[model samples]
Each structure stands twice: as C-alpha cells, then as structure tokens.
Target chain A: MSATTNHPMVRFEGVTKRYGALTVLDDLNLEVGRGEKVAIIGPSGSGKTTVLRMLMTLERIDGGVIWVDGEPMTHMQKNGQMVPAEPKHLRRVRSKIGMVFQHFNLFPHMTALANCTEAPMTVLGLPRREAEERAAELLNMVGLGDKKGHYPAQLSGGQQQRVAIARALAMRPKIMLFDEVTSALDPELCGEVLQVIRKLGSEHDLTMLMVTHQMGFAKEFADRVCFFYQGKICEQGEPKELFTAPKNERTQQFLRAVLEAV
Target chain B: MGMFSLSAMLVAALIAIAIMSLFGDNALFMSGLLQGAWLTVQITLLGSLLAVIMATTAALFRLYGAPPLRWLAVTYVEFFRGTSALVQLFWLFFVLPLFGISMDPFSVGVLGLGLNIGAYGAEVVRGAVQGVHRGQWEATTALNMTRWQALKRIILPQAFVAMIPPWGNLFIELLKSTALVSLITMSDLTFRAKTINDTTMQTIPIFTLALLTYLVMSLTITIGMRWLERASLRGMVRGRGR
Candidate 1:
C-alpha cells in the first residue's frame, strides 16, 4: 500500500445519503486500499454516482462519516468526540481528494493552462512560476502541451476531458474520483480520455474510484469491481471473479442488461 | 437585439446632437440645459458606483450569507424592487428627516436612486451567478477552494461577462430615473427644462433639448457597455484569445 499512515486511503463507515424522500446510499460501508483502482458499476438510479459524489464532498451525506487517510472528512475529532467539521477542517481534509466530472467542467473563461494553475496558486498559495511549471507539466502529461493556450470552448469534448483530468491532477490529490468522465464524449473521443486514464493508472500510486458504464474497462483495469443495487453493494470482489461468476441475481441481471445495451 | 441595432442608435444620437447645435442660437438656453446635464452626469457616475457595490454585496448575501444577513439582504431587495423608485426618492428626501436621517438633496438623489437601481441589479447579478454551470461550482469544491476564492477567481469573472448587457440596461434606467431627482428639488436636466420653459414659455425648444439630451446620454451608456462587453469577452472564449 502507498498509504502514508497505517489506515486505508478511504473508509466509509455506515455512510447514508438521502435526497428529500429518497435514500440514495443506505448504510454503505466500504474501504479503498491506497493505490487500489476501484470501479463502481450499476444501472441508473442505483446510486453508483452518489458514492463518488459523496467522496468528493460535492453532495453532503445525510448520515454517517467518511474517512480519508484515517481522518473523518465531514467531522473532526474534538478531544475525545467527533463533531461536524468547520470550514477550515473540512477544507484541509477535502484537499486530499479531487474529481473529474462527466460534463468536463472546465472554467470556460480561462485558458487550459489557467484552469490547471488557478487552484494551485490561489488555494495552495504556490507562486506563479511554480504553479505554471506544474500546470504545464500536467498539461503535457495529458497530451495537451501544445493546446495550453486554448480555452475550453476551443477544444473538442475529448480534449476538454483531458484538460479536466489534468486540472484535477494538478491539485496533487492522493485520491482521484472519476464521475463518468467519458459519458459525454463521442465514441472516437472516448478512446483518448480512456487512454489518459489508463496511463494515469499505470503511472501514479493513487487510489482511484471511478463510476463508469464501461464494463470492458472496469473488468480489465480495476483491482476490484463493485456492483451497486438499490443503494447497496449487491456484489463486490476481484474483477475477474465478479465478472465471471457473480453470485447475486440482481448483479447478473444488471450485467446482462448492460451487455445487451452494447 | 435585432430591433436594437447599436450603430443605428449612435446615428440617432448624432442627429440629436445636430438638432441641439442647430438651435445653439439660444446660447443661454443651451448653457442652462448643459449645466443641468452635467449634474445629471455626476449623479449617474456616483450613484452607479454605489449601485454596483450594493448589488454585488446583496446578491452574495442572498445566495451565501448567514441566516440573519440573508434576511437583511432579502428584505432590502424586496423593499426597493417591490416599491416605486419615485416613492423611494420621496421617502429619502421628504420623509427621512422625520426619522433623524436628514440629508442634502444631492445626497438623497444619489443614495435613493443608487439603492433603488441596485435592487434591480441584484437580481441581474444573482441570475448571472446562478447561471454559471453547477459543475463549475463542484469543480471548485473538488479543488478544495475556499468559497471566497471560488467566487473571486473562478465564478465572478465568468458572471461579469454575462452581466454586462443587463447592467447596461440598468444604467440607462438609472440615467432616466435621475429625472425623478428633479421632482425632489435637485436641479437636474429635466428640472432645468421645466424651469426654463415656465420662465420663458419657450416650451418647444426647451423640452425637445431635454428629451434629446437624455437620448444622447442613454445612447452613450449603451455604447460604453458594448465596448466593455467586447473587451471582457476578448480573452474569455474561443476566437477571442488574449
């Protein structure tokens, strides 16, 4: 494990999420070992994306606690007890994670290089020269070194997704979340983004949690595969075991449906 | 936008200026109107500065402030937006003295109209801020940005681009509403027209000049805003690289 501490890179202890009357993630307990690539797959409304969203702190969980690098994300230990984290505490813990979205949410007003450098300079307080150097390096890694001056509007969907990935990686997050990063791309474009993901997986010792519909990639790349159903993990195990001989009927049905859709 | 061609408006302003100069034989009449127009310009400048500040603050408060501060912002926007600008001007000028908040006529004009126009501008600002994609905000969170940092570095610059056109309309509205100050006893352009018309009964020339002056001023605002919009977008999107 690449973990700096004895604890797992991420642990979800009895985490529950709800939206008004809907319970999206129910009493979910999961853990990710450092440097493990976990892929979450399920049908729409099965709460697959919510897992990544909750981890990223985009949507606040209604119940339970999430730990990153052995520390609670939404709550902080106060003397002997836990309380909801203050902004300062939350920001500190949350900085360990980063996310890329399906929509490729690049800041439309900034150049590709600016989008990558802004948070590092402003939030991390890196000087312009260092930030720019780091950003330029990441942009090149994502294969957009020549396009750093291009705005989001000027790039293709695939190029934008790569930039978004670079922007997320620019934060030097220990845990990266991919929330359907290629769902919006053209089929030809999906390959370029997937190639970046593949390269990042091989190159970095970072824990990755990807919510995806790409069964092939999940089966091939993920260290473990989790199939979520009705906000519960119906089946999870080694990707080969789960793909070859899933025990849960719901998992089998979901996999069959997904295969048919292709 | 189709009905509101900018070049056509500029041409109309030129025609109005031509008409004003054609009757420049009435030099005293022209000069009196000119002085009034100058006061209008000053009031518009100061009031607009205040309005922009108030609008941005109230919009931020309404969206992200604490409970009490949010309520204060809500009440402010509703009160000023829901009521008449003229009544607001009157209350600040005529009624505030009863409440131990007396001000000179000029201050009242600037404060009252600044606040009233700011109320409308708050909505514009809010719409533009919220109009930014939800994912942009999520991206900020993913990067672990402080709320203030997200707004200042990421959000507001984007929102500013969207807001310029509506803000231009509000500015022109503010310029037109400067006429209301004249009713409260400030010697603005409209007041000068009414006064010189009453004194000399040169109704045709005086009222026409006043109407033309307002048109020219509003046209100037429109032109300035167009320039600002172009300048801002230059570095923002594709084909307009810095």
Candidate 2:
C-alpha cells in the first residue's frame, strides 16, 4: 500500500487557546499529512491533550484557524470572510473527525454495541440493523466482539478504553484523535490497548493524531514524534532521532524526566 | 370560667391517652375515627397525583423552555408557595366565580391541595434534573444528540430516580394539607368530626377522633411512599449496576 500523501489531512495555523488568564496552546502551527500517524509527547502541563481536544471540537480555539481535508474546522469561509461554524458546517466537518477521550466517557446506560452504534444511527441516519452490523465488525476489530452486550461498568478500564476506540472508529471517520487513551488504565492493562491502537495505525489508512506518554509505542508506531513543552513544539523529527537524539534542550530534559519515572 | 379550664384539663388527659395508644383503640370511638381516616386517604391519593403531574410539567418548562415559559413556571411556583393553603382553598371555592368558572367543593379541595404541594415539588424536580453528571452531557453531545433527545433519553431518566425522595416528603405534607379543604365544605376528615361534635354534643370525643384520623392518614402516606421509593430505586440500581 502507498504511504501518506503530500496533502494535509489536518492543519493548525497559528492556533492559540486559553482558559481565563492561562494560555494552554500558544500560536501552534502544525500539520498532519493525509493518512499519517503522528505521536505528540510532552510533560504533564505541556498542552498535548489540548491539541487533540481541539481536533475533537471539545475545546474551542481563541485565535487562528484549523483546517481538515482543506476545509476550515472552527468556521466556514464565506465571501472571503471567516465566520463561526454554523450548525450545518460544523456537522459536516465534525463527521470526518472522530475522538477517543482519555477517560473513556462511555454512556453508562448503554451496552458496548449501543455505544458504538448510537452516533451512526442518530447522526448518520443509518437504520438500526445496519448500524448494529457495522458496530459488530468494529467491535471484533478492537477485540471486544463478545463484550458487545455488556454495560460499561461490567468492563475493566482497559476494556472500556478499547470499546471507546471501537466507538470512535465505527463512524468511518477520515481522521482520528486519541487523547491519553491508555493513561487511565493500569500498567499491565495498558499494553493490550496500546497494541490494538498500534494495529489500527498499521491496518487502517486513516490519519491519526495521538497524545500519549508511551515512549516505546510512539517510537514503534509513529511516522513522526513531536516533543511539546509549554504549549509549543520544542522538537519534532523521526521517532528515532527525536527520542534518542532530540535537538532541543527542553525536549531532552522532558524526555529524561519521563524516562526516569517509568 | 370554672367549666372552661375543667374541659381543657379533661381534653389534655385524653390527648395523653391518644398519644400512648397511637389511637389504636377498637371501641366505637375508633370506628368514627376510621371513617374519617378513609376520607382523608381518598383526598390525599387524588390530590398528590395532581400535584406530582403539575410539579413535573412545571419543572420541565423551567429547565427546557424559552425564557418566557421559564418565567411563567417561576411565577406559578411562587404564587402557590407564597399564599397559605387556607386562603387558596377559600379563593378556589368562593372567588372563582368572578371569572365565570365554578366547580364542586371536592374539585376545589383537590385543586387547592395540589396547587399548594406542587410549589414545593417543583423545586425538588429541578434539583433532581440538575444532579445528572456533567460527563453525561458530554457523552450525549459527542453522540450528536439534540437537546431534547439528551434530556429525554439521557438526563430525565437519571433525574427520575433522584426526584422520588423529595416527592415522597411532599406527599406526607400533602396528607396534612388536605385538612384545610374541610373549610371549603368538602366534608373531609376534619369536617366529619366537626359535624359529629355539633349533633352529639360531645366535643372531646369528636375532636379526638379527628386527631386520630389525621395520624392514620399521615402514617399511610409515609408507608406507601417508602414502598414506591423501593420499587423505583430498584430500576435505578440496575442502571447504576451496583
């Protein structure tokens, strides 16, 4: 199969975000090429999660624009003017992007199958039977085919996160964002979820942006590794060069602390 | 003057007897008490049903409707909670004619009782709906649910479990409030006792029956509410999954 194309699937142009007085993302300019797997690593407060959250539309940007598949994500351009994304515009753009949250915020009342099928039936207007069939296939891919009838509480944290990944993927989204998908799982359970994600990165041609602390997975699965510090990309390169020989001092310091802790 | 304190002293002793036995006497006095108690239960059951419906609709309007409808909900709740039940009962039974609307004494009694308890019930309902977790909202939004869909399928089902306790308390209070409906000529428990007192010339025995009847009504409501709570919470436990 062919690799990523030169065209960008996701791009942020001078994007900035703030919460009250604190600036969480400061004028970030980044792009993920079509069908590429990019891993973002950073210290605790380095805003890696914010980048993924922005792509998910869970948080809004304070300034600048984000483009997805050559269309602006946060707004629509009309007559050379940028306007707030109308409901229709947002729905169209959002349908192409899918997100798996850090906490696996599954609907506690729904079984795993229902969780995966809800959006397809509701937003995509798919029939219930069709949605369920698609959901079953996605569940099998995530190694959760038999757990489809179980509620979120009946599953372990790792199982719930894996189900969340299937739920995000069921939409057949062109781009996927994973924000700390394994951070909430136990150390022993993290590997299974990480393995599923690594399998997705290789098997699917979809573009993915992942924020994680798993250095080994980042080095193994990512086409590019970005080390972020203080809301800025401090260093970015091939995973081997960035992890073993990062050019920036801040990147090295952050890596040293993360490595020592594990 | 000597007769007044004498009767008061005698009634005080009867009050002590009433408290000690909890009015469980099986004598003729208890027979009169039970007849009155039955009427009280009838009024409370019907009145509380009306109250719960009104309270739930008002709470929904306050939480989901436009600003004007929300204001109307607020105004309705405040008007009932602000006025005494006696005054409201009087207004419903007597003053409704100014607008050319008239109803029977029983209808007025139910309306007065319902309107009064409904005010308190609305606050309870509002609090229950707000008690749903914030993360639930996020999950619903991520699924692209409309606001009404989120409220119906996700929020309100969770809120129903929380609303029952406060609603049960209001039901007990409603049992007592039905006594005010007697002044409007409904012949509820308090009215029955007053009629017996006039004909039998035995004020102590009649009023004592009324007190026992009120106790029975309140106890029945309390027990029934506990049963309903258990039934409703069973469903909630299944959703929460232990």
Candidate 3:
C-alpha cells in the first residue's frame, strides 16, 4: 500500500496463536512503524504478551506469517511458495529483534559484563575485546558501570533489569520487545526501569513494542496505544486520545478497573 | 580441589591411619589389602569417567536426538539399568570370552560398571538439565543463540551444578558395586579380602579393613562433589558475600 522504505518495522499478517482449542491471538493484524514506540495495554489473557512473544519467535504462530524488517521471520520462500523457515532463515531474521522478559532472566553464572558480551561474541562473532568494550559502554549507559563485574544475583531488581536492557541493546537490534518487564519489580523499582526504557525510546532510533500494565508510563512513553480485548485490538490511537477518551466498551471497563485498583 | 572441605579430608586420613594401625600386627596382610585398595581406586576412577561420558551422551540423545537415536539411547539406559550389575558383569567377562572377544578382567570391570552406572546417571543429567528455569532458555533464544550454543554456553553450565550431588550418589553406588567385579575375578579389594579370609580365616580384620577403605573412597567422592558444586556456584552467587 506504500513505498517499501515506508514499510513498518514489524507486521503481523493474519497471525494466530493457540493453545489447544483456546485461541490466544486470533487472526491478528497489526503494524508498527519504524522508530515508533507502541504500547499494548490489555487485561490479563488478552494476548498482549503473546503478541510480543510471537514477534520474538518464542511462541509458534498457528496460522499467519510474522514479518520483521521486511522479511518473513517464521517462513521462507522456496519454489515461489511460502514454507516454514529453516534454522538459518529463522536465525538471520531473528537477529533484528531482541526481547526483555518480565523476570529479568539474566545469565546467573556470568557477571553483568559477561552477560552482555556473550551474544555479541558468540552470535554476532565480535572479538572479545570489542564485545567487552561495547558491553561496558551499554552497561554504563544503563547506569550499571560500577557493577559490571557483579553477578546478576548480586544486583537489586531494578539494577538487574537495567542490565537486561543493556544486554538486549548490546545486540543492536532494530526492534525491541518488552513483555511486562516492570510487572515483576517493586513499585519503587518500576520507575528506574521505566526511566531506562524512556531514555531508550527518546535517545535511540529503534522501534519498540512493550506490553505494559503501567498505564501512566504507557501514556507518557508511547506514540500510539493499542488497547487489546479478547485477542483483538479494541481501540487504538495517539496515547493522549486513547487514554483520555476511549470508545470501546471493553477498553473503558478495563481502564476503569485498573484505575480503581490503583 | 582447593575448595574441598578440609575436615572431610582430615577425617578420611584419620580413618585410613587408624585402619592401618589396627593392622600393625599383620603388616603383610595390610600391604596386600592396601595394594588391592589401590587397584579398586583406579578402577573406580576410570569407570566413573566412562560413566560420566555415557550419561551425558545418552541424556543428550534422549532429550534432543531424532527418533532412531532417541530409541537407541532409551534402550541403552533401560538395558543397563534394568538388569542386575552382577549379571551384566558376568555377561561381559564370561559370555564375551566364549564369543572370541576376551578382554582383560580390568577392562571388563571398567566397561561393565561404566555402562551400568551411566544408565542411572542419564536420568540425573536429564533432571538437572530440565531443572534449569524455562526463562533461561527464552533468554538464550532472544539473544539469537542456536540450540547447541544455548546448551553448551548456558544450559549445561547451570545444569552441571544441579547434577553434581546426584552424580556423587551414583559414583558411591558405583564404588560399592566394584565389589561385584571381584565375582569376575578382577582382584579388587573384595577379592583380596576373600582370598586372605580363606587362608587366615581373618574375616574380622580383613573384612573390616575392606569396609573402611570403601567408606574412605566414597567419602572422597562426596567431598569432591561438594567442592565442585561450590566452585560452579561461586561465579553465579558469590558476588554477594565477597
């Protein structure tokens, strides 16, 4: 529908994900523009996390193709027909995307610096010296420079999450996915993590898709907000418009419940 | 080795010394048992090494191999673990000789016990690898690591710490089973004790010495395993205390 250069950084074309008979993401179609920050807000079981997970290829798509950086991530072209992707195709397409989990899943056995350097050295095939230098810079960027030699267990929840962000950023991925990253942190700790994310959104040109329950942060940080309800986008628009005046019944009810809880 | 518990080593040393002192009146008998004990130690070490290799290979095969390879691994694990070690040892030492594949008694002992204990160790490896959190695998995937890279660089290292205690138990079980090798006429500690008993009818001192030596050997395994668990855990957890 537009110039190839104007294509979104990510597109979910009729994507479906299911667990047995339960459809989690039902024939979903969503597009995220390059360098845009899109926040997915929904109630529990709305498939918000699954959307991000499918893009990361952590979950299998039951039906449709997921495109990343203008390439099919879950399939490859063979004989002019689409087929399930080979490992080489999957890996090459996947390198453009990185994810941060809610649990701050740092490699426990490695120090912060090593955690960040591991992928750069092994997957990206960067030299150890350069990897360390890049990791050090990213760790410092996340404000954990002094804790580079410390293991993940030694860091606070906020500190570990910042390191996780740095580890992801070290890969230089164009699209970053965050799956309820602040859900596991303390209320005070949430700010530090959100701040780091906000810094990334503002300072870097990367496109980001975050599944967040933090409505305020979502409103402030996101260019567009998609309110998901029962595996579909119920309402979506500029953050201010969607937050201030929502038209969908489910979105209205969900926001009201969240506000009441707070 | 540096991280090994000193008190455990000291206790083992004291037990050996006390057992030796009790044999003061029978120095020749003591030397014979000691020599046999040394052979048992060697057999245990080599057998344990082989068992480790078999366990890791079989577990990986069972977990990640294709259909045929998976079936082969499962068969090996069940066959070794299901049958009696004594029968397996006899089959290897006796049955194979009749088939014109005679091996040295030492080789039979090592092979039989290695294959036997490794079966039990396969489950240990699998359980430990599976015990690692699912999040670790997702993190590795997000980093663009291949399955092999994930297993080698992340999964196995974490699993190694979890597996050591169970491997320690298997090793001790393997050490105890070395006595079964004497049935194949391998001249381990048990064989020497039996021979000495037949001649001197000294079941009291000779059998007692054999039991003490086995205890010492198993204690060494336990201590060594504990040391390994700690050394692996140090880099993961020691950032807090020191």
Model 1 chain A TM-score equals: 0.97
What are the per-residue Cα lDDT tens digits for candidate 1 across A1-262?
A: 2555768899999999999999999999999999999999998999999999988888888889999998888898899898988989989998999999999888988999999999999999999999999999999999999999988888889999999999999999999999998898888899999999999999999899999998999999999999999999989999999988999999899888888989
| Candidate 1 global CA lDDT score | 0.90
The TM-score values for the models, in the order shown, are 0.95, 0.81, 0.96
Clashes of 3: 0
Name the candidate, 1 or 3, with the larger lDDT value. 1
For candidate 1, write residues B8-42 as lDDT tens digits: 87678667766666764555788899999999999
The C-alpha RMSD in Å for every predicted model, in order, reads: 2.6, 7.3, 2.8
Separate DockQ for every predicted complex? 0.53, 0.22, 0.52
Better of 1 and 2 by lDDT: 1
Which pairs clash (backbone N, Cα, C closer than 3 Å) in model 1? Answer: none
Off by over 4 Å in 1: A1-4, B1-4, B235-242
Give the winner by TM-score: 1 or 3. Answer: 3
Order by lDDT, highest first: 1, 3, 2
| Candidate 3 segments exceeding 4 Å error | A1-3, B1-24, B238-242
